[model samples]
Target: MKFEKNTALDFVLNDLFEHYRQHVVAVDRITSALLEAGVVASQADIVNDHIAFRTLGVAHMGIASFEKIFLAHGYRKMDHYHFAAKKLNAYWFKPPSPNYPRIFVSELIVSELSDAAKGVIHRYTDAIVADPVDSLNLGDGQQIADFLQRPLWELPTSQDYNKLLEESEYAAWVIFNRYYLNHYTISIHELKEGYNTLEEFNAFVEGLGIKLNTAGGKIKTSGDRLLRQSSTVSAWNNALFADGITLQIAGSYVEFAERSVLPEFRNIPKSQLSPQQRRDGFEADNADKIFESTYTAQIKDKG
Candidate 1:
C-alpha cells in the first residue's frame, strides 16, 4: 500500500497500518531488514499485496457490516471464498485505485461451532444490537480509524477463550482482538530480482531467524502455480482477560505473496506489466492454511 498520506483514505489506512506495525514486531523487523539490505529505502517502497481482517459471523457484524468501511471508500467487492473445514466465509475487495492494497475480510461461521462455543461468543457479542459502522460518519477517516480500534465487546475470560480455541481458533482470535489487522501481505514479485520469488524470500526471512508458518508448507501454491505465499508464525503476547488474568496468546503476523504474471500476459514486457497481468484473486486452499499462521500447533512445533 503505497501512499503519500494526501487523501482521507490514505490517512485512514496509514493510521491503521501504523497501529498494526507497532504491535506486530515482525512488520518492522522485515521492513528494517529490507532497508538495510537496500531492497527498499522505506516501508512505502514495498507494495502491499493486501491487508486482511478477521470478524465473527453474528448479527450486526461480520462481512456485511465491516465491509461498509472500505465500500464507502470506493472499494468494489470481488470474488467470494469459503473454507469448509475452517467454517469460514470471506470476500476480497478491489481497491478504487491501483496504489492502495486490496482488502480481504473474513468471518467465522459462528453457528457452525459447538453450542458451548456459540454460547461463549454470544455472551460477548449479544450486546451489538445494531451495526456499529452504521452509526459512524464514514467520511471522517479519523473516526473510522478510531472505530476499527475501539472495543466492540468485553474481553473474554481465559476459560471462554480456551474453550473457543479448542473448537475454532478463528473464534478465539476475534473474541479478544476484534477488528485488528490480521496480517499485511508484502508483494514478493514486486521486489528486486533476488528477492522476487518465495523460495529466495523465505530463505532471506528465515536467515533473519524469523519462523515461517509450516501449516501446509513454507510456500502454499495455487493449483495454477501462479500465486505462491508464505507467512511468519505469529508471536505470542501477553493478553489481559476479563478476570484480570493474562496469557500468552497469538497475535498478528506478516505475509509474503508472489503473484506470477498470467499466461495471456506472458508476451508483455516486464516493465509494462501491471497488477492485472498477475494472478488476481486468492485461493481457498491456500488461504485455509494461511489462516493457521496463528494456530498453536504452528507456533509450538519446533521442527
Candidate 2:
C-alpha cells in the first residue's frame, strides 16, 4: 500500500533518518574502538567498506514508515530471524555476501484489524507509494555525518556512546518484533465465584499464547500478602503477557495506580495507623529502602 508524503509522514521520516544515523555512528564508534584495541587489525577503509556493505541494502524511510503505519492500524510485529552469509574460496566459487543484517519486514496479519479499519488503511496507502524513499538518492557517510552534526542532540556523549550500540541492536530487533509478531493477547472472563489459584487464571492466558514470565507480569491487589505472595509464586493465577504489549500495560497501570491510589492513604496520619496497617506500611517502606540500596550497589558496580 502507498501513503502520501504528508507532514506527519515527513516527521516520521525525519525521526527514522535520525535513528538510522545514530545507529551508524554507534556502529562506527564500536568498530573504531575494536580496531584501536588490536581486536581487528584491519584498516579504516576496510571497516567502513564492511559497514557500507552491511547497511546499504536497508531502506531508510520507506520500509520504516510503512512499518509504523501498519502498527497504527493495530497489526502486531513478529519475530526476527537472521542468517549468516557463507564464505567461499577465491578460485572456485565466490558466494554472494548478504551485504546487510538479515532484513525483516513487519506484516499486518488480517486477524487484528476490523474491516472498516482495513478500508481506512487501504485508502491511506492509495495516496502515495509505500516505497517513495527507495527512489530518493541518499548521501554517503560523510554527508550523513555533516547532517547529523547540525543538530546538537545528535552528537553522542560518553554515556550515550557506551549504551547506543547495545540499545540500537536491541531497538532494531524490537521494531521487527512489533511489526511482525503477535506480542500480546487479551482474554475476557466472567467472574463466577470469588477467586482461586493465580495459576488457573494464568493458564487461560497461556492457552492464548501469552507468556507472563517472558514479559514480566504482576498482580494488582489491595492486600499486602496477596500482592507480595502473588509476585513470589513461580506459578500463579497471574495472567501472562508478552514483551511489547504487556510491559506497556503493566508499566502504565502501576504508574496510574500509584498516582491515583496512594494519595488517599496520606490523609491518615501516622498516629491513626492500626497495628497491622503500621506493620504492613513499615515492611513496604523497608522493602523500598532495600531495593534502593541494591540498585545503587549495582550501579556502582557497573561504574
Candidate 3:
C-alpha cells in the first residue's frame, strides 16, 4: 500500500485504499495498534503485499475487462489460477516495480453457475452489453478511480442476494460489492522481528480483539511452506437492497502474509535479502481457504 503518489497507478491505489480503509474497520484497527506498539510510525510505513478484486465472469466484465486498468499502467499479468470448487478463475499481476503491491483479480465463472443464480445475476448485469472499462480513458487516474467505485449494475434484491448466498457466497458478495477492492494484504515478514511470523502476528492481532478467519486453519500454508497467510473475517455493515430491505452484509477485510526467503537464498544475510529473494506468487490451496474469510461460517465462528 506504500507507494509514491506520482503516477496513475499510485493515485488509483491510494484512492481505492482510502475508501477501503475507511469502511473495513480492521484496516485502521491494525494500523493504530501497530502505531501504538511502535511497529510503525504511520500507515505509510506498513508494506502492502498485495490488493485483490472480485468480478463477475459476464460477457463484458471479469478479469478480461478489469485487468485492462492495471495492465495499462505497466502491470504484467503473471500466473493463472483456477478454483473449481468455488467456480472461480483468477490471475496475479506483477507490479512494474517492487514498490507497488501486486494485484490479484478473480472472477466467478458465470456459465458454470446454476440457471437460477445465472438468471438473478444477469437480471442486473445483462444490460451492460459493452465493456465498461473500454469507455474510460485509462490515462486519467481519477476517472479510473471513480470507475472502480462506480456501480456497473443495479443492486440485487434481498431475496436474490440471499438466494445467491446459499449457492455461492462469492456470488452474493460480487453482486453487492462489484469491483470494490476485496482485501488488501499486509506483508508480515517486512515487520520488525518478534512481529513478523504468522504465529506471533496472529497472537498480537487476536490480543487486540480482532478475529481471524479459521477456514482450513488460522494460518493457510503453501505446499512448499514458503508462503503463509491469514486474514480477518469480513466486516459487517448494514446494506440496503434494491427492494428496500436492509440487512447486515459482509464487506472487505484485512489479510496478513509472510513470504519466507527461498531455500537457495538462505545464506543471504537477512539485512541484505531483497523481496525478489523471497518466495514469490501465491498458492491455489492457500488462496482457496483465504477466500472463506468472508463466508458466514468464519464470520460466525467467534472461536
lDDT of 3 by residue, 191-288 (tens): 99989999999999999899999999999999999999999999778999989999998998999999999999999999999999999999999999
Candidate 1 lDDT over residue span 72-166, tens digit each: 98999999999999999999999998878999999999999889999999999999999999999988888998999999999789999999999
Q: What residue pairs are clashing in model 1?
A: 1-48
Please give the distance, in angstroms, between residue 274's alpha carbon in candidate 1 and its true position after superposition: 1.2
Off by over 4 Å in 1: none
lDDT leader:
3
Instruction: Order candidates by TM-score, high to low.
Output: 3, 1, 2
TM-score of model 1 vs. true structure: 0.98
Clashes of 2: 11
Q: Write the per-residue lDDT of candidate 2 for residues 115-195, one digit (tens) a residue.
A: 543343333334443344334223233332333223211222233222322323222222222221111111111111221
Q: For model 3, where is the 10-residue window of minimal lDDT?
A: 1-10
What's the distance in Å from true for residue 221, model 3?
0.5
Q: What TM-score do all the candidates reach, one by one?
A: 0.98, 0.22, 0.99
What overall lDDT, based on C-alpha atoms, would model 3 receive against the true structure?
A: 0.94
Better of 1 and 2 by TM-score: 1
